[model samples]
Target: MKHLRYVPGLVARGAALAAALAAAGLPLVAAAQDLRGPLGAAPAAPAAPAGPRNMSESVAAVVNDEIISTYDLAQRMRLLIATSGVQPTQENLPQFQREALISLIDERLQLQELRRVEKERKINIVADEEDVDRQLGELAQQSNLRPEAFVTALRGQGINPDTLREQIRAEISWRRWIQGYYGSRLRIGEDQVTLVQQRLAAAASKPQYQVSEVFIDANRVGGMQAATAGAQQLVQQLQQGAPFPAVARQFSAAATAATGGDAGWVSPGEMPPEVDAALEQLRPGQLSAPIPVRDGVYIVYLRDKRGGAGGTLVNLKQAAVALPQGATPGDEAAARVKLEAIRTQATGCNDLEAVAGRAQGVVAGDLGEAEVSDLIPAFQEAANQLQVGQISQPVRSPAGLHVLAVCGKRAAGAAQLDREQIENRLYGQQLSMIARRAMRDLRNSATIETR
Candidate 1:
C-alpha cells in the first residue's frame, strides 16, 4: 500500500546506463571521432606502434595471469567516453585509461569468481544470452535506434559491441552472484525498521535533501590526492554539461552507483558529517565541490529540498456501492449493508479490491495519492481519521454509499521508510559491502601487473 518508489532492479539499471549515455548530448558516433579534439573536429592520428606487430595484441594489464589486452582497454575507453559523455582530451586520456584498466581488472576478477563458483557448485551462475539481449534492447531504445542499428552505430565508432555486452554480462552476473550469496542470510528485524523510523521521526523537523552523489574512493584510485583530483575533474565535467547520473554510473564507487548514485532523500545526520555540511550550502539544482571524507571524496548534487514540517500526503483507496440519485431509504440502507459486509471481510487494503469483487454493484479502486487537505471534504475527513490499512465505516457520498481505506501516509518532504523498504535498503547495503570486501580480498591475493 505504501507509495514508495523502490530502487530499480538489474534491468532498470542496465536501461539507465544506456539512457544516461544517450542523454549525455554526445552524438552516437561523434564521441569516438573526437577523442583528441572537440566534438565535430577530426581526431589526431596515433603514432606508430612500438612493440607488437598487432597493436591490439599488446598487453595493458595482467590480472591473476589473465591478460587484458591493449585492444580491450581501447574499446573500453571508447565505451567509457560514449557512456560517460566526457570529452576525451590529451589531458584526461591517462585518467580514462586508468579507469578503463581498473574496470577491466574488476570484470576479470568477477568473471574468475563466477567460474570458480560454477565449478565448485556444478551450477551455472552466468547470465543468459537472453538477459543480455533484453538489456541491449533497452540500451538501443535509449539511443533512439533499433538493436541492430545501435550495434551498427557502435561499430561505426570503432567500438566492439561486445565490449558493452560483456560489461552488461559482468554486472548482471556479479549482481546475481552477490544477491544469491548473501540475500537469505541478511535479515531486517521489526526493531531495526522501528529504529530507523524513530530516527526519521526525530529529524522530521529538520531540512530534507534529495541528493545524488559521485564518490571517488581514495584507496581504489591510489590515494587521497588522486581521488581528490578525480573528484574535482568529475565536478568540473558535471558543471560544464555532463549528466550527473551518467558520470555517476561510470565513476562513483558507492553502492548507489548501481542506480546512478541516487542517495534518495536524506536528513541531516543520515549522510557523512562532511557531506551533510556540503549539502546544506547547496541550493536545489546546484552541485557541490568535492568534499573530502575519511576514505573518499564526495561530489553531491542537490536535486531538491523541502522543510521537514511540510504538509501530509496520503495514499487512499475507496469502494463505492452505487445507488440512484434520489434512492429510497431502502436502497441506501441496502447499499450500506452490502458495504458493511465487504468492510468486515476485508482485513486490509491489499485484499480490499478482491473482497469488493464478491459483491454486485460495488466499484472498488484507488483514489490515488494526494495531499490530505487537497482531498475533498468527505475523503479528507476519512483520510485524516484512519491509520494506514484501516477501513472506514460506510458513509454516503453524492454518487453512492462509500467506504474509504487509508493505504499510507508521509510528511510532504520526507520518505516513508516502510518495513519492505527498510529491508531492501539494508539488503543492498550489506550486499554491496560484502561484494566490495570480496573484491578487495581478490585484489589482495592476486598478482596484478600493469604494462
Candidate 2:
C-alpha cells in the first residue's frame, strides 16, 4: 500500500545511457531521423585511435556476434569518471576502467535480451515524450542547467545529444520489458496482506524495551578473535554496572553510536538472529552476552520497558464515484449530494455496502481490516476518531469522495503472522533474486568491445 517515488539518479543514469547509445548509431530508436542535429551541421567525428593496432590480439570476450572494442572501453571509463566526480588517478584508472567496461558490457547484454523478449512476446513498449522530458528536466535540475544548456554541455564533452537520449530510451525499454514479462506474475496474495497486518498489530501491542548496544566492526578488525575480545571487555563493563550508552558512544562503530547506540524499540524478529537469541534468554533490565553478528559482535543491555495496547485496526469500505467529464459547478454539486446521501443512509459498517448499492451511481470497494498508518492520512484520521461500527460522513480525496465505516478495532501487540503473509514476503524476495540473476546472466553473455 506504500507509494514509492522514482529516484532522480536512476532516471539520470537511464537517460545518460540512452543518449550514449543513440550517439553510437544503435537501432534503439525508431525515429532516428527526428533525433539528428540541424541540416548542414557536420556530424561529430569519433575520437581517433590512441595507439597502433595489433593484428594477432585475441578477442577479450564475445557477446553473441558483437565485439567490444578497447577504444570503447577507454571512452566509457573517461565518461564514468567525469560523471561520478571520481578523480581519474593513475593508481585507480586501470581498476576503474576495467569495472566500467564490464558494466557497459552488462548493459548491452540486458538491452539485447530486452529486444529478444519484446519480439517474442510481441510487446509494444514505447517511451513517451513526457517520460523523456521528465528525465531531462531532472538531469538539468541536478546540474543547475537548463535543457538546452545540458545538451550543449554534452556536445562540449564530445557526447552527442542523440546518444544521451537513446541511452535513456534503452533503459526505459528494458524496465518496460521486465514489467511486461514478469511483473504481472509477481503477486502478493490476500492472505499475505492479512498476515502482515496481524504481525504489525502484534508488534504494536508488545512491550517496547529501550536498549543500548556496542557493535565492534569485525570486518575492520584483524580477525574474529579481536572482535570477540573487544565485545568481551564491553560486556565486562556492563556487568560492573558501567553506563551502557556512554560505553557505546565511545566505542560503537555503527551509525546508531551518535545516539549512544540506542535502538528505540526492537521487536523479536527485528533484531539480528544472534542478538535476538541472546535477548530471548535475558529478562527486562538484563545485559546480554556478546552476540555474534556478520563480521561483528554486539553487547546489548535492556535499559527499560514500556507496555501499552498500541495497535489500531480499521474496518472500512470505499465508494469510487467518477467525476463528471467536464468540471462544471452543477456536476460537482450533484456528485457531492449523491455521496452525502450514501453516508446518511448507512446506519453502521454492516450497512455500508447496502447503502452504496442503493445509491446506484457510486461503486463500492472493501478494504476489510487495515492499520491506521496503512490508509491515506485523511482516511486514517477519520477512522481514528470514529467508534467501532460507526459510519463516517462522505470525505473528498483525489480519487473521489469516500464514505468510511469503522467496523472494529484491535489493540497493538506481537502476534504470529499468518502463512499467507510469510509466503508473500518470501515470494517478493524470490522475485528480487530472480531479477538480479537475469541481469547477471545477460551481463555474462554480452559481447562488448571497448577502445
Q: Rate the local accuracy (lDDT) of all candidates.
A: 0.76, 0.57
What would the per-residue lDDT of candidate 2 be over residues 324-396, giving only the tens digit for each residue? Answer: 3455667667777887887777787677787788776788878877667667888988888898877777766
Off by over 4 Å in 2: 1-9, 12-61, 126-134, 141-144, 157-163, 197-431, 443-451
The number of clashing residue pairs in model 2 is 38
Candidate 2 Cα lDDT to native: 0.57
Off by over 4 Å in 1: 1-56, 310-412
Q: On residues 129-162, what C-alpha lDDT tens digit does candidate 1 reach at each position?
A: 9989988987798878799877766665556778
Question: Candidate 1 overall Cα lDDT vs. reference?
Answer: 0.76
**Residue 208 in model 1: lDDT:** 88
